[model samples]
Target: MAYLKERHLFPGGNTSKGFYSFYKYILSQEDGNRILCMKGSPGSGKSYFMKKIGAHFAAKGYTIEYHHCSSDNNSLDAVVIKELKLAILDGTAPHMVDPIHPGAVDEVLNMGEALDMDALFLNKKEIMEVQKKISKTFERAYRYFAAAKDIHDDWSSLNAESISTDKISTVTESLKEEIFHTQKSGYGADRHLFATAFTPNGIVTFAEDLVFGFENKFILNGGPGFGKTEIFKKIGSTAQRKGYFVEYMHDPLIPERIEHLLIPELSTCVLTTNEISQTSFTGKVYNIEDFCKADVIAANKEEVAYCSKIFYDLIEKGLSLITDAHTIHDELETFYISAMNFDVANDIFDKVVKKFEKFE
Candidate 1:
């Protein structure tokens, strides 16, 4: 069966203060998969090359996971062919990845070798200027995020009394028991994904895909700062201990918050969301919002609304800054594109694909 799924490794905007990467988890030892890390500058055709590889395997009935770039949703960061136990990813700045088991299970593909370095060096001054502009715009974006985080923290603190940690724990314990029945020996690997991403359509999520292979699913409905992450952590940890590979999908706005957990061994999933309606869920609906104290919500209603407005407004500003950074990045790409030899790059990529055909 050919299956395709897309997920983000990092979120766009100020959600993460520094570079956030899931490369370690993707290239973990447990999977024993070969990683072909591509090294190249922007517009060197890394993304295009990976996509061609993905399409080739997908046509041969392999399940493919497309890891998308957070900054430019149109581009891909990596592609995985799970059936072949293989992956090829972009190994560059902000998400640079190196071979853990070089000459064994990992190797590097230098796409930059196909570039005319002499041509690129001629435009060094212009390229450096654009790079500096990109850095400045990204800094502005993070500042907006820092400010938004402050407002969100205040809102959480104000509503702390309304949320019951004990209740959250109890619910989690019950879920653990219900799912696992009896704990198993050995630990399974953990994988990370971003359910929500900053795309051209604004913030978007692939939440529905989380329940694809599961017979039983739980859709959690609640607001932020309500111990949702704690609940997900407990369940995911429990499943890992019970020897089930778990895919943890995190929230884009709040990096610490896990929005979904897929335990493939048990064919089950637990997803948290406020935007998706319960009626649309294929499985059970768990409305954790009911646990909130109505009286506390009533008393803090005005402050909550004001804080929320401020947080969202700041987030919008941060996103706009990111958009500006991408604009500068696009201009920077022109120099690299001019230096790259597409004909040579395409030939190299085809050879890479032919090597994978041995697996068939």
Candidate 2:
């Protein structure tokens, strides 16, 4: 059976305000593989091109990973074929990717070339103004995230004293030994399933998709600063050392914190979140809340609730700004769409299909 997995490269979070790209990991030539980098502006059919390629491979019973855009979940950022060690990604702004191996292992497919340059230049002034507005909106969103992070940090600090180091060590060691019986040999790949994208609706997580084929699943439930990430990292590190391909899903807001780990070779998945309980998965849950100082949490219940509200409110404000940015972005895309030559783009797409046919 084909094993398909989905994930996000960049999350909709504070880190996105800077350069936080996982494309280098995806385009790594460690295995001497090839990558098709699609270079184009918005509405140039880049996402559609990736979707078509993914569908073509899925039809042939190959496992494909669809990397969705953090800003617009409906759009795709990349598609991966694990068996072939190949990937096709959107190489544009915010996450611009350049070929490390150039024509050898990496090549560029300039979809923007099919656009009418003269027509685009005709609306250059309006396009520039819209671009500026888009940037400003994103800046405002990041400012909101920064404020939210401050409140979150304060809340986490309040509970930091309640975390038991002894319990963390015990849990980490036990989980490590159980997950990785013996260190095999080589290292493995690490990946993220979400980006810094928080929409007005709320946060998005593809945890279920990542664990779809796993037979053994463990959900670790605990409060903030409870060492859940430490446990996940311990197991993931051991798994990587033991020669298992590991996908480490990081918390969008906290990149250093691991949210989930998937070792496909063993069909094992370990997630650290209480939200998994809401899912259909009937996995064994190991509650780490036992190690937390319940008395302290109970004492500061009101303070905790207040801080949580502040964090959520700031995040909501950020999401509102992002929504506005997307609105302007949509208008920006209209100009590009009008300037593009779909007929030529279709011909190029057909050629790309023929190239993939050779893979069969």
Which lDDT tens digits does candidate 1 get at residues 1-360?
Answer: 112343334322236464456666654555745788899999898888888888888888787777777777778888888777788878898777888789678899999889999999999999999999988987787787778777887887777668877777777877887788665678977888776665433565666664555677877776666777888998898888888788887766566767788887777888775531122556776767577787887898899889989988987787788788888899999999988898999889888887777766
What TM-score would you give candidate 2 relative to the actual structure? Answer: 0.91
lDDT of 1: 0.74
Candidate 2 Cα misplacement greater than 4 A, ranges: 5-19, 192-197, 274-281
Model 2 C-alpha lDDT versus the unseen true structure: 0.73
Q: Where's the lowest-lDDT run of ten residues in candidate 2?
A: 10-19
Look at candidate 1 and give me any clashing residue pairs. Answer: none
Count of backbone collisions in candidate 1: 0
Show pairs that collide, candidate 2: 8-193, 10-195, 11-195, 11-196, 11-197, 12-195, 12-196, 12-197, 13-196
lDDT per model vs. reference: 0.74, 0.73
